[model samples]
Structures are given as structure tokens and as C-alpha cells.
Target: MAMARRLVLWGVLAACVAAGAGDWSPGTATFYGGADGSGTMDGACGYGNLYSAGYGVNNAALSQTLFNDGASCGQCYLIMCDTSKSTSCKPGNTITVTATNLCPANYALTNGGWCGPGRPHFDMSQPAWENIGIYQAGVIPVVYQRVQCSRSGGVRFSLAGSKYFLLVNIQNIGGSGSVGAAWVKGTKTGWIQMSRNWGANWQALSGLVGQALSFAVTSTGGQYVHFPDVVPAWWQFGQTFTSNLQFSY
Candidate 1:
């Protein structure tokens, strides 16, 4: 009976793994960048100059739901052309892309928002799309799955806007690199939730000019890291702070 129970458990685990793999859904893909594309800098996710830092237009913009209001920023995805739908797809070819921006809801026209309601979709950079599908096809069927992001260096926090309206951009994240939620606390105040304003950026509308700030971050994989007093009281707008804390895979 014990041996039979072990086999049953193994069977259940295999079924779970199969279900997870089947979650990768078919979707439509479109490309941007180059003359007709959205500019490489100043994306809705607040990531600027996507062409720099060796990324070089190898990025993508996801629709509202997929964007998860910036939670998907810095996340990676494995995308493959669905050859079953089009002859232009290269058999067994796939391209991995980093989510760097948000494709606004207005662009969703036919199939929910750019990455919304109906099916999963990716607005990839032209170069990234061409890596797996014929350029002339414009749009092609694809299947995508979220993957772990590989990054180096510690996490850095960049402050923007004014003291009353604070915006913090988290960068150089590691492990399950995308942030799911972030909270901030000042010297004397209780923890305040920060709302995702765009790619990698979390914002809070409060006067925190003179207080030292501590942060707590949760990653997509449910790992949490609390950075106590990561920012000094003297931290000023436009300045950046680095924390020694990081999430593990």
C-alpha cells in the first residue's frame, strides 16, 4: 500500500507539471521599433533608452493584463512562432524577450487591450519578432511562457519627481527579477503601499522629503525582501540608492 501511495503521488505531480506546461496559450504577435515603431526611449513602464545597455531593441511591450501594471517589468518570456497557423514561421525557432514597457489599452481594439481580456499577445520589437517569424507577415501566431530573469548587480532605487509626489524606479533586480509589489515606510510613518506607475516604477503621494525610507519588495515568484533604512534621510530627488538585499530563485 505504501508503494502504491508513492506511485500515486508521483502520478499526481506529473499531472500538475503537464497542466502548467499547457498553460502557455496561443496568441497573436506584432512588432514595433525602427522608423514606424514607437520610440525606443520613454516607454509607458518608465524604462528609457531601450536601445542602450546591450538591449538594443531586443525588448517587448505587453498589453494591460500581461503588463500587470508594471509587475511584469524586467520579466522574461520565451516566445515561439506557431507554425501550425502560418507557413512563414520557422520550425522550432523561438526568441526570448524582456518585458520593458506597457502597450496601452487603446491599442487593443479587436482582441481586448494590447495584452488583455481574450488571449495572450506580445508587441515585440521588430528585431525580436524577426528572430522567429517572417518580417513581411507583420502579425503571426505565437505561444509564450514566463521565464526567470537573469540579472547582475544589486538592486538600485532611483527617486524621481518631488518630495510630495514620489516615484521610485527599481532597477538591477535579480532572481525572479520582476517586482510584484512594493511598500515604503518613513522614519515615523507606518508602511505605505506603493502603486506601480509604469515599468519598474512605484509611486506614493506623500511628503517624505526629510525622512529616511525603508522598502519591502515582493517578487513575482512570491519571494519577499525587506530593506530597512535603505535610503538615507538626506536622499534627494534624482539621486539613487542601492540595497544589499536581493531575492533568491
Candidate 2:
């Protein structure tokens, strides 16, 4: 009897730990980008190739409600097939994915648009979807929660745009990966705030050529990080810079 009592106590403790994890919210999920997730490349987040951006195949295109007009770019989500709602769920399985695109609503399709406006849906990469559900299910009821992103190395900045317009796509961010705001500074100028161009890209109309660049970024979670002189004076328009600093998860 004592041993049984101890087991019950352990079970209750484990349940408490699970409850303390991020609050699960209801949603639906579907697979896309083929079985290898190759079709998911060059998504709306401006991340280019998922592999090149360090997001790998574990990525998803979120519905408008969750996409937040690209403000949710680079954010991470923990998803699980809700076994209580579907028999196709791979029980006890969950996957973590990064938001890399938008699952636009298709008003033309009859009952086919799961990612319509106001709906919290995830059009996940095939590999990611398979991790938590059977392929035959196609679409499944799911529960997901926003979670801190886990990334290797530090953040990366890909530079683009023309002589007067500077566009930077920030990638491989950790913690709350969605960037709320960003600012750039040159060796000779004061901090110039950048505007969200689209997706994870931030733009500034200032000409900052031939100057070593630094950046201050703030996440949607309100955490701030600064990378000083991350780009050298010789930086080119197509160059990408890496910083050794990252936000804590």
C-alpha cells in the first residue's frame, strides 16, 4: 500500500510539471512542402532556404491569426497532435517548429481553407507534421504553445537592398525569436531605427556604406540585445554577418 501511495504521489508531481509547461491552445495542423519539405524553401518570412537559415525542415507557415502580419516571424511553437480529438495522433509525440511563412487563406476552396483569417492553423512542413500525426490523417486537431527557440551559434544578419536603402534579414534567433523592433548604427552616425520591410527583414533608408555596422534588436517578448561592430567596414550589399551574442532561452 505504501508503494502504491508513493507511485500516485509521483504521478501527481509529474502532472504538475507538465501543467507548468506553456499553456496549450487549440489549433489545427496540415502538412505541406512535400515529404522532404523541399517545397517550403523561399517562404514569406524572407528567410530564403530553411536549411540555409538554420531552421531546417522543422518549420511551419502560420495562419493570419498567429502570423501577426509577419511580426511572428522566426518565432518558435511547440505542437502536439491532440489524441483526445483524433485517433490518428501519434500519441505522446510533439514537435518544435519555427515560423517561416504565412498560410494565406483561400476563400475559393470549399471547406478546404483551414488557414483562413482568424483561425489559428499551422501548415507545417511534412517532416514536422509526420512527427506528431499519421500521414493518412492529412489534417489533425492540435494543441500548440509559443515557446523559446533553441538555436545553434548566434544570430545572423543577411544584408540586401540598394545604395540608399539597407535591408537586413535577421535569422537564427534564440529565445522569443520574433523581432519587435530593430535599430542600426554606423561608426559615424547615431542609432537609426529600422522599419519592418516584410517578414524578418528590417530596412533603413540611410546610406551607411563603408562604415562598420552595429545593431540593436528587441524581441516581441521585450528582451533586447545589441551586437556592436558585427559587420566590418568592408561589408558588401550581399554579405551576411554573424554575431556571437544571443538571447537566453
Candidate 3:
């Protein structure tokens, strides 16, 4: 009797895991940005300007889980409209977008708050939404999946705030794509782990203004790279540095 009960529980657990691992999920999408071509500049993930030439205006804001509270920053996704639900959708058409911001929390007392109670959703830019569905639809059902980020040149790091605060933004990442973990070290101190501040930005609260900065990054796909002396000792706030290292897909 005991063995049978254990087996049943195991089977149930396996089924639940399988269901959660579905390749495609159903959700809703809405668009932001207008003729002025501006959306929220201070994305939860710390990206300051989404309309810049580097990031472009085509980006998205995802719900909390999808946003992973900033871990999903710089992540790429391929989203397609569900024609069965919205007839206006172009058959088999899809749009690729980079995760740049976080959708605001639903504050309603009922119906699970802002983004629909932790539901999978995308708050896309108007240009991105237009790629797969008619803008007139306003909201459309869709499916999306993570894909590797592709970019040219090396990875770049930008310093924000003061050197004592040590906020760094990692950009132009390539391969397994999104950053999962980052560590920083100065000339005198040992490796210091940095916390994700938002989007591609990470922060370490320490005083290392005069020491060079080196970094090690781990991607969401589990790959890792160590960049030594990526930032010179003279690095200062509001400055950007580039490293020749990147991850393999």
C-alpha cells in the first residue's frame, strides 16, 4: 500500500512539471509608444533609453515572472499572434523583440491586478505589435519563446551613479544571450558579486574608484566568461567600456 501511494505521488509530480514546461503558452499583448516615439525611459530593468540607436524603439515590457525581476533584461523572444483567437493576425507571421522593461504591477483588488495575476503577457512597442497583428486589435493573443541574442562587436559596460555605488550596465551581449549572474573585482579587492539592478545593469556598493574593474558573467543558458581588466583604473561614472570577450551559443 505504501509503495503504491509513493508511485502515485511521483506520477502526479511528473505530470505537473511537464505541464509547466510547455513550449508555447497563451497570453495577451498590448502596444506602447506613439508618434512621438517614446515610452517609459526608466524601465524596471534599468535601461535608460529604449529609443536610442543602439537599442532601437522595438522593445517590450514583460510581467514579473517573465521579467524575472530584471534577469530577463536583454533577453530576446520570438512572438507570434494566435490567428485562431484573433482572425486579424497574419498567418505564421512573427516578430522578434528584446526584453527592455517591466510591465507595471496590477493594483486592482480583484482579477489578479495589472498584468492579469502573473499571466504571461507582453507589453510591446507599437512597431513590434504591428509586425504580427493589426494595431486596431489593441490586444491580441500570442505565443512567445526565448531565443539567443545576436549582436556585433564586443560586450560593452556602462558606469552609472558614483564610483562608490558602482552600477554597471552590460550591453551588446551575444549567444545564450541573457545574463544570469555577474561578478566584479577591483585591483585590491577579491571578486565581488554584483546584483542585478534592472535590465542589463548590475551593481556593487563598494569604494573602488581608483582600481581597475574585471568581470565574470554567466548567461541564462549556463555559459560563463571572465573578462580581466575590462575597465581601466581611471574608470569613472557615466563612462562606457568595451571588452573583447563574449559567450558561445
Candidate 4:
């Protein structure tokens, strides 16, 4: 079945090749490693979608994943190379693409390790990495949000309420969320629950449960961890209501 899918994808790509646009538009979205191209993904596991500049409601679950080098933990990708010709670049070798195509905004790519650019016609994979996870690196349905804000149900000098929301922001890599968080002047007296839609549930965060890691999310720059909020009293405002998460494939 998987082979059939690969053949189908290859066939579609080949047709594009026939039209002299195999690498047109999307421009050869490539993955060169992994167990026989079983895990070379450029999108999310459940939500890999493409939308026009102004289209909405694009939430489709993905059927497969992209991987490169199954036995290896981490690998580096060098794309937009020289398109010069066939080459057998090794793990430590720097493969160059000779293709001369400008990178369109939607024509994006990412790898576990750092990649380079400026040259054209390139698509090679090498080994130089940090983290080792097959499910890493891809243009996913970045789910930035705010979820689970609460306060002590009944604690000393604290009141509780359960009016929560999962702030949703549909953004791409390195984008910021719509909120921020901080340790309210008086937050050593309660607890809350919050998280971006990393998995659709608010899991407790570490430290200063209510006021920890509270900072304005200028960018989706950290782990999509959840932090609970508190609404102790009518006038009680938890300064830490400003947290968010970023989902990457």
C-alpha cells in the first residue's frame, strides 16, 4: 500500500516533470533520507493543508509523514542546490543544488539541522544534527492558542471560576501568539490551567504554576507548554494570562 502511494506520488511528480514544471510552483518539495522515503514530511501528521492567500476552514488531517534517514537521529538538508548533475554526497559532504528557482513564500522547507541558501538547484541530505525524532521538521498547521484558565475553586482568600477558552491563531513558523502572561502582583495564592492546542488539552506547567513562565508571547518561541491561570476575586487579575503554544511537524 505504501509502495503504491509512493508510486502514485512519483507518477504525479513525473507528470509535472513532463510538463517541465515538476519543480514549478511548489518546486520539487523534496526529502532525501529516512527508510526509503517513508518519513520525509513537510507538513503535519494530521493537518497538512495548503490554502490560497485568503481561504479559510483548511483543517484536514494528514495521512502520512515525511522522514529522512530512519537509522539516524538527526540529519541536515541542503536544498536549492546547483542542479548541476547526479552526485553522491556523503553525510559530512555539503551537497549543492544547481537549480535556479527563487524560493516562493509557500515554497518553504525545513530540516532538523541548519540549512543554507543563495545557490540554486539543490536538494541533498547530510548528517549533522542535534535532536533525534522522526516526527520533527515540517510546515504543520501551527496551532497557537490559549486554553484552560482557571482559579482555585475554594482556597484561602481565593475564588474559583471555569470560563476558559483556547485562543486560536493560525500562523506559520516563528510567529507570535495573541496573548502574554506574567506573575500577577499577588499570585502566590492560587492555581490555573492553560496551554496552546499542542494536543487539545491543558497540561500543568512547571514552577509558579499561576505566575511562572508568564511573559508576553512576542513569538511562538518556546515549548507549547500549558500554564494555568487564576481569577481569584472580582478585582483579581492574574498577570500571567499571557501564554501560548506553537505546533510544528
- Steric clashes per prediction: 2, 0, 4, 40
What candidate 3 gets wrong by more than 4 Å, as runs, is 1-22, 35-37, 51-54, 107-114
Q: Candidate 4, residues 73-139: lDDT per residue as tens digits? A: 0111222211221121111121211111112322334442122232121122212111111134322
Query: Deviation in angstroms for 203 in model 2?
Result: 0.8
Best by lDDT: 2
For model 3 the local lDDT of residue 210 reads: 91
Alpha-carbon RMSD of each model: 8.2, 4.7, 9.1, 17.2
Candidate 1 weakest lDDT stretch, 10 residues: 47-56
Question: What lDDT does model 3 reach?
Answer: 0.74
Clashes in model 1: which pairs? 45-199, 63-115
Q: What TM-score do all the candidates reach, one by one?
A: 0.75, 0.91, 0.82, 0.20
Model 4, residue 71: what's the lDDT? 11
* lDDT accuracy of residue 79 in candidate 3: 79
Off-target runs (Cα >4 Å) in candidate 4 are 1-48, 52-169, 173-193, 199-216, 220-249
lDDT of 3 by residue, 124-153 (tens): 888888887787887778867776677666
Candidate with more favorable, higher TM-score: 2 or 3: 2
TM-score of candidate 1 to 2 decimals: 0.75
Better of 3 and 4 by TM-score: 3
Every candidate's lDDT:
0.74, 0.87, 0.74, 0.23
Residue-level error in angstroms, candidate 2, position 6: 24
